[model samples]
Target: MSHDALFQLGMDLEAHPAPRAERAAGPRSTTQTEDTIVAPVPARDADDRLDHFIEKQGIRCAGAHLIIDLYEAERLDDLPYIEETLKTCVEEAGATLLHIHLHPFEPTGVSGVAVLAESHISVHTWPEAGYAAFDVFMCGDAKPEKCVDVLERAFRPSRTAVSELLRGREVA
Candidate 1:
């Protein structure tokens, strides 16, 4: 089938809502009460071009943003460590790291960002609460999930909550 045909098929599938049972059986819920939905996107053939499909489908951006909450993180106050881990996460996600910047608060806590060719990964820590907020956004062929392992290993949070969003989706 042509790229436009395949893209149209995907749009048609998305337009129809899934059955309640199918939606409920998606990814398990974390500490948060809300259940995460995992809808399957139609796969492209080997010869199909991703950019063409996205363009034909009126998709503004092929990207994902992962909003993560790290509770009881062990190294919330470690600036250097957080910076290194952010860089590592970008690398592990197969994203090219353009630059990294970190700022340490007066007494404790840290904030950092790792700019990537795909997008960016950032974090803000609150040592007093033993918590950290992370935003991992990536576009193109980069896999954002690859950075999850790095965050878990580095922070050692007692409880982690994650919410993912497909950014720049088709409006109509």
Candidate 2:
């Protein structure tokens, strides 16, 4: 569930989820003095914060996003197996999982997402083609690279293709 949804249900997940903050169009705080107005300064410090962006390879970014493609994969239509794999990925990546939601398409195929405190892991599968696509994105100290190995073991993909992108790469 989303942060607001969690609150509505009387559960507080976190003080501020970084993923939503980066993309939210919410109310802004401003201070008006006798002559001019002072714009709000965002909270960027890491004090008392559990998850935040980090510097990787001399480039500062919010997180790493990995595009993993599995070919000749097995059990692309099994929802339970897929869910377990996602959970395992989250655990292996050292990311905190918040919620999991999956959908099974008609005929054959399963798509799912595992929401994490660091970020998220999503999957799209094609059983007929023996293929699956997975996206593992996380920030802070979480290691998204670990998911590739876990996925290979779970799906038993004969061949895999992987690509990486640094999310929220700020301009210098």
Highest-scoring model, lDDT: 2
**TM-score, cand. 2:** 0.72
Give per-residue CA lDDT, model 1, range 87-144, as digits (tens). 7897788777767767778888887677776678998999999999999988776778
lDDT of all predictions, in order shown? 0.72, 0.81
What is the lDDT for 165 in model 1? 81
How close to the true structure is residue 75 of candidate 2, measured as C-alpha lDDT? 92
Q: List model 2 lDDT by residue over 69-120, tens digit each.
A: 9999999999989988888898899888777777788999997778777888
**Worst-scoring 10-residue span by lDDT in model 1:** 28-37
List candidate 2 segments past 4 Å from native. 1-46
Error of model 1, residue 23, in angstroms = 58
List the candidates' TM-scores in order: 0.64, 0.72
**Candidate closest to the true structure, highest TM-score:** 2
